[model samples]
Target: MKEEIKKHLENAITSYHHYYASGKLAAYIPALLEANPKAIGACILDKEGHWYCAGDYEKRFTIQSISKIVTLALAIMDNGEESVFSKMGYEPTGDSFNSLVRMEINRVPKPYNPMINAGAIVVTSMIKGEDNNEKLERIIDFFKRLTSNEELSIDGKVYLSEKETGHRNRALAYYMKEVGILSLDVEDVLDLYFQQCSILVNCQDLAKIAMVFANDGVDINTGEELVPKYIARKIRTIMVTCGMYDASGSFAVRVGLPAKSGVGGGIIALSPKKLGIGLYGPALDDKGNSIVGMKVLEELSRKLDLSIF
Candidate 1:
């Protein structure tokens, strides 16, 4: 099985490496534009804790919006489900992940689902902490436990870049505050949000973290329960419905797994009790998803029969 998976990954990487050319790096982020647009990578962790990998799997990139999943888990773990839901919603917004159209036009009482930028900021505010640093520490600690890697830290350059160019995010935060859904100071919450999005990881680290979700909150290697079963289930559900921004529904129909993508061209996906996948391709398609990364997952899903649907 291991050899088969390895051969399969090697073939997929070779076949899809050219797809990166059709997309471009997330140039708007400024810091992300420096990445080699052609860089592509993938890693898979099976249920037995064995790994199969290809391409630049060891190269680190910002987790970007993928960090929202961990923040939601931490918010739920600390404040409970009801408190977190009260501040943010669980529905998918068909608009772009960064779109404030729905939030402003509809006057949404809560940001629709924690996956979007608006919702993610609200979710970050709900995380229990005395200050921005404390909140960020909690998140960092949780991710360390999830991946069993304590050396993980935020990419300071990416964090500052996001903080500077995140005007839309700032507007979203202020709007949430005006709607009575946000209690923390707008900049403080946005600081934590940016810091979380800047968390540094590579394809291998992402697969390790996804493996925890694949195991329903239990560490696949240590067999320790890091997240409660109920919280893990709810998180996966949200990932299916809202993870890919506006393309989530299509991704769900095609790939049929819980997954998340970041503008940094990283995607983490899981099939329950089966396998966890991680991929990075700095080039992004129209929906802000990794072009080669999505192709790799689609090919793997078809070849491996990994769809949970």
Candidate 2:
């Protein structure tokens, strides 16, 4: 089975590698522009401890918006569901992930969901910490545990790039602050958010993290509950509904998995008790999802009958 999955993965990479030409790098971050736009990779971990990988699975990239799921999980662990959900709704916004229009038009002005930039900033503010350093430490620690990689760290260049070019994010944070949705210092929250988004990861690291979610918040090898079952369910539900930004509805129809995509050309997908799949393809379509990664998953899902729907 492992060999067969690996063979399929290799074929998928070969078939979709040229799709990179149809998409573009996430050039807005500047640091991300250095990524090999043609690189494509995947890694899969099954519940029985089998592993399969192909292509550039070892290549590293920033976690990007994928960090939002980790922060949201940590915030729920820090503050219960009620407190966390009070700051943002769980519904998907058809607008862009970074859109501020909803906040402006709504009477309450809170972010629609934690997966978006505004909602993720609000969730970061909810993290319990005395300072940004402590908050970031806790976040990094959580990520380390999730991926089972103690060496996971931020890419300093990407962190600086995000900090310098995040004007739109700053506007969202400050607006949320002014509207009473955020009680914490806006800069501190933004710093933590930016730092989290810049953490480095590879396809293997992402597959391990997804495996935990596949097992309903428990570590597959150690049997430790990393996240409570309810919280895990909540996170997966949100990922299905909002993880793909404005294109989520179409992605749901095409792939039918609980998954999340990062602008760094990575996607983490879950197949309940069966498999945790990680894909990386930096070339992005207009919606900011990895175009090659999307095609790879669609092919795998259809071939393996892995979709939940």
Candidate 3:
């Protein structure tokens, strides 16, 4: 069975490499522009702590918008899921990942939830911090604890590059501030938000992070509860409903795993007590998701019969 799963993973990566080359890399974030658009890697962790990998599985990539999931999980811990949702929401949004369409159509510019840029900025504002660095430290600490990797650190080049080119995100933050939905200073909040997105990790680290949710938020190595059971369940629900930006609904139907993606071509996906998958392919489809990443997950799900639906 181990050999079979290994072969399956290898086949998936081998068959899916071309899909990465066809898709474009995320260009809006200046730092993401530097990634090798052709690199495709995957890491899968099974229930028994076994690891299976293929392709460029060791390469590090920016967390990109995927940082929203960590911020949301922390918000749920700090403010409670009910309070967090009271301010945001859990429905699938049809707009682009960074789109501001609802602000013009609706009376309020506030976003539907924390997965989008607007909502992520608002959520970052709520995290208790003395300053931007401290807030970023808190987020990094959580990721490190979850991944059991003390080496986790921000890619400062990525952070500064994103900050330099993040006019749209800045606009979104300011608009939220205008409506009383955002309380923190816009620059400070954005600084924290962008820094979190700049956190660096490879497929191995992502797989460990996903396993926390897969096992209901307990650190599998230590058996310590990192998040409450209810909160963990809520995290998975949000991943399914909103994690892929606007493409979340289709992802739910096809991949059927609790997952999130970053524009840097990284995806973190998991099956509860079953498996955690991390795929990195620096090419993105129209929806800002990793194109080859999705293909690999779909094939794995089909062959492994893994689905949360």
Top lDDT prediction, candidate number: 2
Q: Indicate whether candidate 1 or candidate 2 has the larger TM-score.
A: 2
- lDDT score, residue 114, model 3? 77
Candidate 1's displacement at residue 146, Å, is: 0.8
* Higher-scoring candidate on lDDT, 2 or 3: 2
Candidate 2 per-residue C-alpha lDDT over 169-229 given as tens digits, one digit per residue, 9 for 90 to 100: 9999999889999998888888888899999999999999899888899999889999999
Compared with the true structure, all predictions reach lDDT values of 0.90, 0.91, 0.85
Task: Please give the ranking of all candidate structures by TM-score, highest first, separated by commas.
Answer: 2, 1, 3
TM-score of each model, paired residue for residue: 0.98, 0.98, 0.97
* Residue runs of model 2 more than 4 Å from their true location after superposition: none
lDDT of 2: 0.91
RMSD of each: 1.0, 0.8, 1.3
Clashing residue pairs in candidate 3 (N, C-alpha, C atoms within 3 angstroms): none
Best by TM-score: 2
1-309, model 1: which lDDT tens digit per residue?
Answer: 788789888899999999988999887789999899889999999999889999999999999999999989998888899988977788998999988787676655678889999888888888888887788889999988987888999999999999999998888888889888888889988888899999999998899888888888998777899988888889889999999989999999898999999999999999998898999998999999999999889888888888998
- Please estimate how well model 3 matches the true structure, expressed as its whole-model Cα lDDT: 0.85
Candidate 3 Cα misplacement greater than 4 A, ranges: 107-109
CA displacement after TM-score superposition, residue 215 of candidate 3 (Å): 0.5
